[model samples]
Target chain A: MDRLLVVRCPDLLDEDEDGTALRSFVEVVDAVEAYCPWITAVRPGLCSLPARGPARYFGGEDALIRSIVGATSDITPVEVGVADGLFAAVLAARRGLVVPPGGTPDFLAPLPVGILGNPGLAELLARLGIRTLGDFAALPASHVLGRFGADGVTCHRVAGGRSGELAELRQPLARRRVDEQRGGGRPGGAPRRATVVDEPGFWGGVGDTDVRAGRSLAAVQDLLGPDGVVTARLQGGRGPAQRARFVTWNAREPQEDSTLGAPWPGQIPPPAPVVVHPTPLRAELVDARGEPVRVSGRCLLATAPGRLSVEEAPWAEVTAWAGPWPSDERWWSRSRRKSARMQAVAGAEAYLLLVERGRWWVEATYG
Target chain B: MFVASPDRRDVDAPPPGPSPRRSLDRERDLASLAVLAERTRPVSSSQTRLLPVVPPLADLLPDGGLRRGSTVVVTGLAGGGPEGSGGGISVALALLAAASGTGSWCALVGLPGLGAVAAHDLGIDLARSAVVPRPGAAWAEVTAVLIEGVDLVMLCPPFPPRPAMARRLVARARERRSVLVVVPGRAGWPEHPDLHLGVSDMRWDGAGTGEGYLSGRRMTVTATGRRSAARPRHRHLWLPSATGAVAEDATGTGTAG
Candidate 1:
């Protein structure tokens, strides 16, 4: 998950028929973008950017947040906060507090379940005596999935602080409104090539396959809606999921300086995993004594890993393993995390596993 | 500064006039240029119409490249579990690398959480590839549509495709002159492909009991197909060598039968 800094203007959240609030929100985005180039307009009045780079540039997160607040205060009263994921970051912005790294779960535990934005689920949980996120997080995942379906499982993960995002947090249509304000012609800019007026077989012209592909992909959009088809663009980040961003195939534009050539200090070496779970899978690692293995505060393993099970599947012997690469990210900021990653080869498969808060999760697979 | 340099330059220079022309006329020159352009096009030859394959995996195909209208099935474990699993996704991705790099468009259907970095490491042109991670119940229809648009389409059916559906897709690929690469993970393909590649015996070379990082992996790839490639051929390869490109595993000898 990304360590994000969210800027929220409470008064500008709702749009007026006269378009007054949206115009002010655009000003807020422009002011924030002056400090950081990667600021994303999550919605009409909310925006976020990865906190690591900007924090490093302007002394620290506190200084950076202060500078942004100072810049945007003229346009609209702005609140800024940094946290691990977008959902927590938004909540942090609301309270004007920075949630410390590896502290999101603790931060979310005391909040009411209604904060999840799903009133129906909250009302149901309220009846079941699960009023707070902490109580909801305590339910066994299997029971949650059986009762709530996939959406429930997702909410369960977010409430437990194991995951950082919820599908309802951002409205894509609102983001498009912000994009249109930035003068990129139409919302997503033009398609990469001029597929409409194609001059096939001529130099510098679109090919026959490209035109055919555009038409077919448009057909898919008709079948599965606009968000169905996507293309991946490479970006610099530590985790596999963070390194790439998937955008609607038609709306994708060439982003500059998104190559892997940029130096990322703590990234895992090459031969990157072929599968990065969008949501990390739960795992249990135990020693021969059947005792759960742990990583100490000093970054040392409690015992040699003997067996491992993912999603409560049958245990497989841990044949070979690598470092518990300590990731002390954003240490300068209050949102610092003390997680570690390891490469474990069990049987015929290899997995990039992450351990945080004494819980293990399968982050990626080298298949 | 020096005025005599003009005469000195003339000693080594040819008289300026109309540029020399070839003895061949304009019509002949145009014909020769046309032949050069046709031969230099990315396709192997006009008759066979083959797409290029990476050098390490060339021998796995009967035509030394992907035939324009052929179906290839790649089988391996699908998901990760406590029991360990190796997906045939890497091989399927490797097949797309060479063709897409040479300006061919490709599409991936029904594979989720694609490790984009790994695809880039294997030399795939991400700009030219379209990925439909979750096609749901419409995976077959999605694959059929992609076959008409892209030069190569890699399909991992989200469900066990019915025999009729699989046959229809295979027939569609044949008719459209597209290369269909299927990574039939758990949802097996019912129709027989022109070429079948299976991945097995995966072993990691580095990282033993909290030691070095993952440097490389050795795996056995068996290729069997119809007609010219009726006999099975086994080859050992580093699916992802230390730098993340396919390479021949020198330690083991391949057996062809």
Candidate 2:
């Protein structure tokens, strides 16, 4: 069994709200770590330090005890008890007793069963004429299990000071902290250096931390809306400035990059139109004679009209006309919505014109 | 003179008296020294550290750029502008471009539907930027955390926070030395901004229906606040000039902003 030293004060452990006991516990542990670096776990009133390596390093168990007593002497009035395991050490510390190696079970049996702090079990044990740990242990193990179930068995082991397993070790923030005073030049105690996460291309690592954080962020976004999140989806459509549109991030049916495979047409000050109406507005495309005008498949106006009014603009003469660029999506489907998108400029203002199903729509106004 | 020369000690002693010429010369030296001191007086270096704006746009800022730890209110037309959509929002993003490039994270709160393209085109690094579309009731909490962690936080406050809450946020931003750019909505600002930047008279380029492509936009940007004189400052800007970058209209009229 692994030998442990538990340092605690019984009276302070039960005091609630005021964290005076916890502070003293940490102070005692920090002081002990200076002399013996093999400190493991700490609690509000109890701390367990494995003593085999430190005992050998400091010459003997007696010398190690002297050193620990000297280190935390000025802090809290502490009881340091050494035993084979943590549960027994804590019990021994309560009584200020030290058990010789392999003598933990024998030393523990005579102690009161009430020390385990399980009220219901302690009350039942008292009723069963088992006031002491020895009486509890003397009872058949299978009988205790049958009566009190799993909790009774655990209490029985702890009362016997025969806990066979070591508690799991905790190492949170173990790398980020260093005690310069106690471990000035210790190689293992050096400050943490930059890791792969600091590198620009460190995203290649499996289960990347950034990606994990992004997943949580996306989850938050999902809680807010059905749309995954608004992302910039730049398009290679005729309108260069309006090429970027707010699209909901969909896991399925993602929009293809409009310009990814094909060579981008222009460089700076893109030639495509700047403003795109994400949701095209329905409007009337009239002719010069103030009548609803229609343009045929070849983009030829049937009896050219003189007026252009989309989104209720003052019927302005089309001072400039760009293109009837064909904008067709899902042509094969019966519900295919196809239209010819045209750019019209009237005195420093540009409008996106769409003719679909014999109806007109103003896609966007550059103004 | 001959009698004084006869006794060398007496001549030397008697000559040791104040003369008008020497006194006048001493007074002249003192006056010249006073003038020299006045000419080299100490200059005030009270100008605070600032977040960088592009060189052309810097002139439009009161302190030549966004002031650190100071909240600047940027007001733009609510919905009516020749320039398509939130003009003030665009200005706010454009101002943060330099700051983001300096490797500071910028969080945009209360702004939804601001796609990545326009921000990218305006030179903001979206990799280091965060956009919180709806910060409803947790706006103050989110703003506080963002300001504490990041160097710059842009909040579009939909309504005025409680005065005490607003003061606390301002205090935290000051303590943390982070720049807070608040785009006050119709409710107005809870606390007075150190600097106020407003945009008006925005005109779009590109003419006659489809005759010419929408090339660029020009807006008149006005800046005024407590630190500046009561007189408002003005400047004309081609927000996204022909080259697709913010530049000042050199021909446009303006005093220093």
CA lDDT of each prediction against the hidden true structure: 0.78, 0.60
True contacts kept of each: 0.67, 0.13
Candidate 2, residue B120: lDDT: 62
Per-residue lDDT of candidate 1, residues A192-310 (tens digit): 23212223432232354565666556545545666788888899888777788888887224422246688898889889888887778898988889998899988789899998888
Write model 2 residue lDDT over A1-367, tens digit each, in one string: 5798777755445435665655565577678877656664344455667778888989887788788878887886778888897777776777777789989878877878777767798899889888988788877654664576445655665666655321221121221222222344457673422221222221222123223223323332423443434445565543333456555543223224433344444222332223344455566666766778777787655644455655564555555555565666422236877566666554334455767767776665543
* lDDT for residue A140 in candidate 1, whole number 0-100: 79
lDDT of 1 by residue, B143-240 (tens): 87777767899988889999999998898889889899998877788988999988877788789989889998888888998987888877788988
Which candidate has the top score in TM-score?
1
Give DockQ per model, in order.
Answer: 0.26, 0.07
How many angstroms is the interface RMSD of candidate 1? 6.6
| Chain A only: TM-score per candidate | 0.52, 0.43
Name the candidate that leads on lDDT: 1
Write down the lDDT that model 1 would get: 0.78
